[model samples]
Target: MRVTLPASGTEVDVKSLSRTNAKRLGEINSKIAVKLAAAKADGVTEEERKSAAEELKALLDEKEAMIAALYPDLDFEALPNRDVLALIAMTVDYSLNVPEAEIKNWIRSGNGEQTQAA
Candidate 1:
């Protein structure tokens, strides 16, 4: 799979995400889930929730990010600002061979009907 960074104009050759990276992604998502639950329980303001979300996203850029590992030349710090969205999308689509437009439609419609088997 390949991902292009819009800000830096760099193309990243991603050979399907590693199991370790998948695990890390899952862990981060779990943390977000917990935070969201807590925010709901505490009746946190939307602005506060948004701040927490921004901080969680910053975690993706901290240290040796999984996306950085996919690019041979760039480290986490070298990644362009606002380009992390591309990396996240590429990671989710890795090995699936799903077209970008289809993915976008799925996201828009929130319909998760599975493809029929042969």
Candidate 2:
């Protein structure tokens, strides 16, 4: 799958992960979710929050490694975060065979219709 970076407009070629790599990706995602939940739980201490942040950063690094393996030409670390996020979203959308209209609808759902004050 080919996707254009949102900020730089650079095109990237992404490959679907093999079953083993996909499993690794799923594990990384699960770890991230657990860390996020810990960080957000009520009565969390500052130290615990910091620990969660570090864990989340490590998980993000793992995810970047997976993405780099799939898209060797992409300098994933150097790209702006916005572009990286856009690239990830596009890659997942393509991998899942999501329609463009569905993506547009999802984006629209975030903001709904805007109205002007009378």
Candidate 3:
């Protein structure tokens, strides 16, 4: 399947990722998750959280960097919304490592709704 990078014209073949790509994505996403969780759990006011979120958007560069690593041919260094693209990468990677049923369970746990067939 094709996954297009947000704010950029580049596209990635989601199903073409290799084990190495998945591992790299997992490592990078783990770090991103930590930062995001910490930002949300800091007990700050809404305005403060908004400020923190703006700062946290910088992490999108790291996500784009990982994608560039997986696809050397792509130049995503200047792309916008790297975090969104990175998320798509993670979903594709996770899908490859699990069965359809497990993916469905995972999605339901996240958004509290059953996922449609892939």
Model 3 Cα lDDT, one tens digit per residue, 1-118: 3444444545555444567866765766676787677767857688866765765576556555555565566554445655345545445655466553454354332322455657
* Every candidate's lDDT: 0.59, 0.68, 0.55
Best-fitting candidate, scored by TM-score: 2
Model 3, global lDDT: 0.55
Clash pairs detected, candidate 2 = none
lDDT of 1 by residue, 6-37 (tens): 67766665456667766777677687777767
Per-residue lDDT of model 2, residues 42-110, tens digit only:
999999999899989998887777666677777877888887776666555545567655543433323
Provide the lowest-lDDT 10-residue window in model 1.
104-113
The clash count of every prediction, one per candidate, is 0, 0, 0
> Candidate 3: deviation at residue 34, Å?
2.3
Q: What lDDT score goes with residue 73 in model 3?
A: 62
Give the Å shift of residue 45 in candidate 2.
1.6
lDDT rank, highest first?
A: 2, 1, 3
Clashes of 1: 0
